[model samples]
Target: MEVYSKKQQIISAINALRHKNQTLGLVPTMGALHRGHLQLVKKALENNNMVVVSIFVNPTQFDNKEDLEKYPRTLEKDVALLKTVNKTNILVYAPTVDDMYDGLTVSQKFDFDGLEFEMEGKFRNGHFDGVGTIVKRFFEIIKPNNAYFGEKDFQQLAIIKKLVEKHNIPVNIVGCKIHREVNGLAMSSRNTRLKPEHKAEAPFIYKTLKTAKQHFGIKSANKVTEWVEKRFAKNDLLQLEYFIIADAKTLKPIKRKSNKKTYRAFIAVYADDIRLIDNIALN
Candidate 1:
């Protein structure tokens, strides 16, 4: 696999591929590659003629400086892992922060049609705006035929879909399934920072979600939320931030039965210093 740090070289290379009528696919990721990320690469390779994996830890997306500082960076290892993929045609774009945003400034704010004011949006403050800025910039630079994103960040995926729609970006956005550990903990870069003991208890997040999903239709939304809160409270290691059953599409909290609309349970919790988020369909 060839690795390019310069934007012009990668763009020029991709242009050459376009000349040959080779379909291009993009997998955007912050490094410290895990099985969850590799799954995206695998999907891209299967359908597209050539795949470009961009490893950029976008600074604009992080509202908390400490969170940004602590975010994992395993570039060398990440590249080595990408090489292990079965596909022969793969390029890795590992750009520096300046490489992405040297002279460019994102002044225009995006309206995700109130989709941004829900769970993650309510907490992270400018998080999705930062996400939109970097992603839009990448789309401009790469201009791939299709882009792959994991469903792990479901809300972010929804906002990105809106970003493409409002801007009329000419690429298909594909949301792959969420990958989890054998123990049910959602795979995440932050998992590396979990203390050994906390790591053991981390699976409880998924366990609680499964329990909530089971009780979803049987019990009221408030009761299910209360049960999850109490479950986390029982263990001091896991701190519940917010847990709500909401319309899967709008992400607005649901207090009563909706016969037509699909609902999902969205959750955020702090396992020690590492914050993890997960959601499950209730329909």
Candidate 2:
């Protein structure tokens, strides 16, 4: 696996690949990669002629300084894992923050108004703007033919789709399936922060979401929210951040008579300061 830290060098490498009639695919990620991230790389490799995985722990995306500081960094192990998957043609762009944002000040922010104030957005203020900024930077740098994101971050995936279309960026945004563990907990880099006990209980988020969907149905968004909230509240170790039944596309809180075509039950909880997020569809 070849690692490129400089923008010019990475661009030159990509251009050379293009010159050879290779189609480029990008999987942007923070350094602490897991099965979820690898799934994206696998999909990229399958569909595109060349795949580039970026492992930059973006500081801009974190709303809390402590969260940013504590975000995991296991680049050595991550690269080794990548090598096991494939080595010869894989490219890793692991660049510094300075390289990513040389002259770019995060002046303009993406509001995404309704979508910005629900589950993850309401709990972690300004989080998506930071996400938007970093992703915009990534798109500008890589300029891949296709960019892959996991469906676990449902709202983030929606916002990025809007960002790409609104800005008229030429890349196709591909959303991959949510990869889960044996116990059904959605795979996430933040899962590493959980203690063993917390990890065991972590699957409760998915289970709660599933229960809400099965019992209440989309016609009872409020009831679904209340049920999920109570489940989190019952767990003394869990501090409920937000439990929302929202329109998947807009991220707006669903109303009783609202269209139920695509609804998602989203939840965020703090298990002693380790915030975990999960969502389930209500369709």
Candidate 3:
């Protein structure tokens, strides 16, 4: 378990392995290192000869300045947690913001077809652009044969797949199953910021989504949307920001899901000021 911060350092290490014909995998993260993140690393290690887990809290991705400031930066704790995975081939890339951005922290706009205008894109302005820029940078720097992400951000996963196709990047983008708490809350770095009571109530987000999945075929998409909206509205602890049943590929909200098209339920919730997003396949 070695650590490198600069892009050149990791690139140098990866290049050495490339000469030996070793396959490489990457798990890019903002580094509050939870079990969810480790799952990505484990999957990467199983498939590739080497793995790089990046720990930069990218500034370009946050539309709200304070959310960026308040975002967790537990580098020491993060490294310690990564060590618990107990793999020698694993390496950590904990770059400084300056190291990653070279001083300027701006996101390049990307066209994710119409996929960018729904859910997360609709709410967090310039968010996916930041995601695209950093992800593309990592793919360029490490040049991994495979990259792993969790499906918790279902829409973001779709955008990244589109990104690879749009750019002709060679790396395979792998979406892992969502890791969750025993209580059913989708694991997120932001979960660390939840208030005590709110933390207890957070599992309801997944619970509600599960119920909504149960209702999809019986109810129309609009009615299911209504059901989810009402479920959250009745909850006193958490606020529903948006919930949509959309075609999985294009991400357009659907009136009625066709057997021909795969669909999923996407939700965003606000517990006081902290925000969380989750999705589940409805078919």
Candidate 4:
């Protein structure tokens, strides 16, 4: 239930835990805690002797300044949610941007082996660079035995796995499941920004994704893409930005069947100004 804002304090705390022979787990988040994020914390608690949840809205990761500014920051509520965990070993490392970047806010370019060139990377230029930079910094600072991330950011998850592999970072990267609302809308901090009507319509995104998953094997990849596109085109509130069926690993768009072990339906939609993303495994 403890919180540390400064780098030295968190470092010292982790050192004390290490001396106690405690294994550390980390959940990196950009505040605005929702049930989805708490699910990640729950997984971390189950595995590690001590868990450090780092909540920092990293500026280097946002390609759009407006998007960065509009991103939610509910630190007080976030801490309250964490406090309800009933676990004393869980602590929050809510550092300031200055503490993270030391006043030099810039993203380092990374070679994600072409994994960064598709979907989110193509749309949000340098987005992966920002993600890589902040994630790498956290790994260096916390030096935890394990780190957890949700599969909602499937592409980001893939790139991070590559990041660890290429850099040989000595930590296990665990990808947790995507949590959703009752109507099937993927839980997100951005969901708070949705207008009432848009909130009602948002569940359709997941509905279509589920229906698309059903069509996946029967229809061709390209045909399934078209079906999902048409479904969104009829909606007035939600706009489909990009929908692609791809090899889950490389993220290369799949126009036809391949020998790859996995394929996934990746999507991004614009619910007016708020952009939401979700993915489903298509086997």
Candidate 5:
């Protein structure tokens, strides 16, 4: 796979493809590639003539400096993985922080129609602004016909849809299914940092979600949430942060169910020092 770290070179290359009427796809990611990331690549390759996977750990998105500092960066291994997926027609854009924001700053406001102030937005201050900044930059730089993302970051996927519409960006935003481990943990780069024992226990996150789903129609929202809390309380290593059932579209908390609308249960937990998030559909 060809790699470009500069914006102009990549843009020039992509424009050459555009001249040929070649359809381009983009899979934007932070380094530390895994099965989850490759799944995105696989989907992109199936649909587009050319795919560009951009791997740069965006610093501005982190609410905590320490979290950003500890975030994984394994570029060599990441590239190797991408090559294994497809060495032809795939361009890896591994750019420097300066490559994206050389002299200008990117901190802008977005209106998600009240979608921004939901679970993730409420917890991580200024986090989505950073997400918006980097994603907008990549959208402008790559100018792909389609951009793919995993629904593992469900709220982020929702926010990105808003970002595209609010700007009238001429690209289709595609949300692929959440990739998971055999034991059911939603695959994440942070999963690599889990303590060995914590890794063994990490699948419990998905297990709890499944349990929550099973209890959905059988129990009230408050009772189902309390059940999730009690279930996690049984595990000393798993610390529950917050659990709520919210409208799938608006992401606003739903106190009760409606036959006309869909709801989902979103949860955040800490396995020792590592934080993980997951959500499940609830009828």
Candidate 6:
């Protein structure tokens, strides 16, 4: 893997690959790599001639200062994992905040309208705008033929697709399946902060989501969310953040459904100070 921190170097390297007729793929990340991230890289490898993964934890995305401070950074280990997978044709772009933002102030913000005001967006506040800005910048810099994102951040994925369409970006956006641990907990960098006991109970989030999916035909969104909330509330250690059943695309609360429609149940919880999120789809 070739590592480049400067913009010109990265662009030059990408140009070289383009000269060779290599189809470029990009996996934009916030650094703390996990199985979920690697899954995206694997998908990119299969579909594109070269893959570039950007690992900048954009400060603009974090609403809470402490949350940003606590967010994990395991660069050495992350590089080791990438190397083990023989992602040799990969470029790891780790840039500073100044390098990313520079003199270009965040004057204009991209909003996914209702999509940004629902579920995670409602809780985080302005999170998607930060996400949209960074992703837009990455797309401009990388200029990949294709870009990959995991479905774990389903709402983010949806908003990014909208951004690409609204702005007329030329890259093909691909969504990969959410990668999870053997016990069903969605793999996340935040999971590292959980206490041992909390980690064991964490799988229940996914379990509940799966259960909700099974009962989507019988239960209303309100009932499903209430039940899940009650279950999480039972554990004093777990502070429920948000539990929602909404349209997978718009991320808006779903009403009565019809055939062939897809709904997703998303949950965010605080196991002590560590916040974790997971979602499951009902088709």
Among the numbered candidates, top lDDT falls to: 4
Q: What is the full ranking by TM-score, best candidate first? A: 4, 3, 5, 1, 6, 2
Candidate 6 residues lying further than 4 Å off, grouped into runs, are 103-107
> What tens-digit string does per-residue lDDT give for candidate 5 at 1-283?
7789999989988988998999999999998999999999999999999999999988878888888899999988999999888998899999999889996655667777878788988888888888999999999999999999998888999999999998999999999998999999999999999999999998988998998899887888889889989998899889998998999998999967889999999999998878899988877
lDDT of 6 at 49: 85
RMSD of each: 1.3, 1.7, 1.0, 1.0, 1.1, 1.4
Q: lDDT for every model? A: 0.90, 0.84, 0.90, 0.92, 0.90, 0.85
* Model 6 weakest lDDT span, ten residues long: 103-112
Q: Which is the winner by lDDT between candidate 5 and candidate 6?
A: 5
Which is the winner by TM-score between candidate 1 and candidate 3? 3
lDDT of prediction 3? 0.90
Tens-digit per-residue lDDT, 1-283, candidate 6: 7888878889999999888999999999987898889889989989998899898888878889899998998887888888876667788888777778896635257756677788887788679888999999889988999999988898888888989989999999999999999999999999888899999888888888888887776988778778888888787777888888887767778887867667888888888888888888788
The parts of candidate 3 lying over 4 Å away from their true place are none
lDDT of 4 by residue, 65-121 (tens): 999999999989999999887459787999998998899889888999999999998
The candidate with the higher lDDT, 1 or 5, is 5
User: What's the residue-level lDDT of 98 in candidate 3?
Assistant: 82
Selected candidate, larger lDDT, 3 vs 4:
4
Query: Cα lDDT for residue 158, model 1?
Result: 90
lDDT per residue for candidate 3 within 159-265, as digits (tens), equals 99999999999999999999999999999999999999999999999999999998986989888888888888899999999998888888888966578999988
Scanning candidate 4 in windows of ten residues, the lowest lDDT window is: 253-262
TM-scores of all predicted structures: 0.97, 0.95, 0.98, 0.98, 0.97, 0.96
lDDT of 1 by residue, 165-272 (tens): 999999999999999999999999899999999999999999999989999869989999999988888888998889978898888899678799899889999987
Model 3 clash pairs are none
Clash number for every model? 0, 0, 0, 0, 0, 0
Ten residues in sequence with the least summed lDDT for candidate 1: 101-110
